[model samples]
Target: NTDVTDQRSAEEQSRYLMGELNHRTKNLLAVVQAIARNTARSTMPEAFLDTFAARLGGLAASNDLLVAQDWSSVHLEDLVMGQLRTIGADEDVRVVVGGAPFLVCPQHAQVIGMALHELATNSLKHGALAHPEGRLRIVWTGASSANWKLEWDESLPSALVPPERKGFGHVVMVDMVERALDGVVKLEFRSSGVLWSLNVRGPGVGR
Candidate 1:
């Protein structure tokens, strides 16, 4: 009887560990999917490699934060700052971030982190951050404990024309980011600049 009980206990522990492993594996796959999908959006081979390398670096930074918390959740500020720093856009003169304090699930952190990376990249390439006299303002407000909204607006020195075609950045925001978080994304390309707004449902937010 003693031996049988020990064996059963060991089996139960093994199952528990397997469950944990599955969760981690799923998260890793999600990250890989994001990378693959975004990378596929590039048109030129050279651009693809460079963009992929930079995006993967951003994903890794977000993963580091989530791993530190045992994959529970990540702080809003940390998520935003990590993406900004990863893309080398953390400068105060060019970028502005303001939001209420809160936490987001690990999945949300990863998705939003990638979205931010894309936005920063686009800003640097074609939007406000591309010009010396441009500025970006990012703001967020919580509608309730379970709902929040974030906005990105870029101001340029002069009016600029919108792109003739939608790019990978648009796909990342409208398809991947929106579907993953069950969120709403709106992109407005004005002559003066670009504006992006995201409404998120923070269902798995952690304290």
Candidate 2:
């Protein structure tokens, strides 16, 4: 009787884990589908492959960290640096990240990570990372547990005008972060450059 009970317990645990894995796999696949559709919509026929591949690489980098930690949590600094490093942002340009260490769960980490990837991509293209003389500063502030605000400030050669045709980067920077993280985003135009701010709220803050 005791042996039978133990076997049943083990079987139940196995089934539960398999179900969890299946559910998470579906969720991940949905995210990838969205990325594919959006990337296709925004990229030119000649540029689609490169653009889509790079975006997938960024997403994979975030997933790599989560997998390494067993999806428990990821540090904000690590996510920021990892995403930026993908585009050689750390080595190529003047960049400063200043903030207390922040940690977020897997859901928040994925959104924030993609947001960083998009922001860094834009910076590399037209913002501070584009030129040797330009500069970028990133900072975040929050209380002990919640209400975190992250700011990405840039000092470019001159002010930037939003492109006439917006792209996936814009959607990720604004819409996706807001909707996914339940956060508020503020985009400011400055004389020197652009300021992107995100205020994160809700239950996903990690230890």
**lDDT of the candidates, in the order given:** 0.81, 0.84
Worst 10 residues of 2 by lDDT: 198-207
What is the Å distance of residue 146 in model 2 from its true position?
Answer: 4.5
Candidate 2 lDDT over 1-207, as tens digits, reads: 999999999999999989988988898899889999999998888998988888888999899898899778888888888888899886554899878877878988888888888888888887788877999998888835557888999998876766667688888888988998788998766767779999877555555
Candidate 1's C-alpha runs over 4 A off are 1-19, 143-147, 201-207
Q: What is the lDDT of candidate 1?
A: 0.81
Q: Write the per-residue lDDT of candidate 1 for residues 70-166, one digit (tens) a residue.
A: 8887887788888888767886588888887778788678778888888888888888889989989988887356777889899989887888887
lDDT for 170 in candidate 1 is 78
Model 1 lowest lDDT segment of ten: 198-207
**Model 2 regions lying over 4 Å from their true place:** 91-93, 143-146, 189-191, 201-204
Per-candidate TM-scores read: 0.83, 0.90
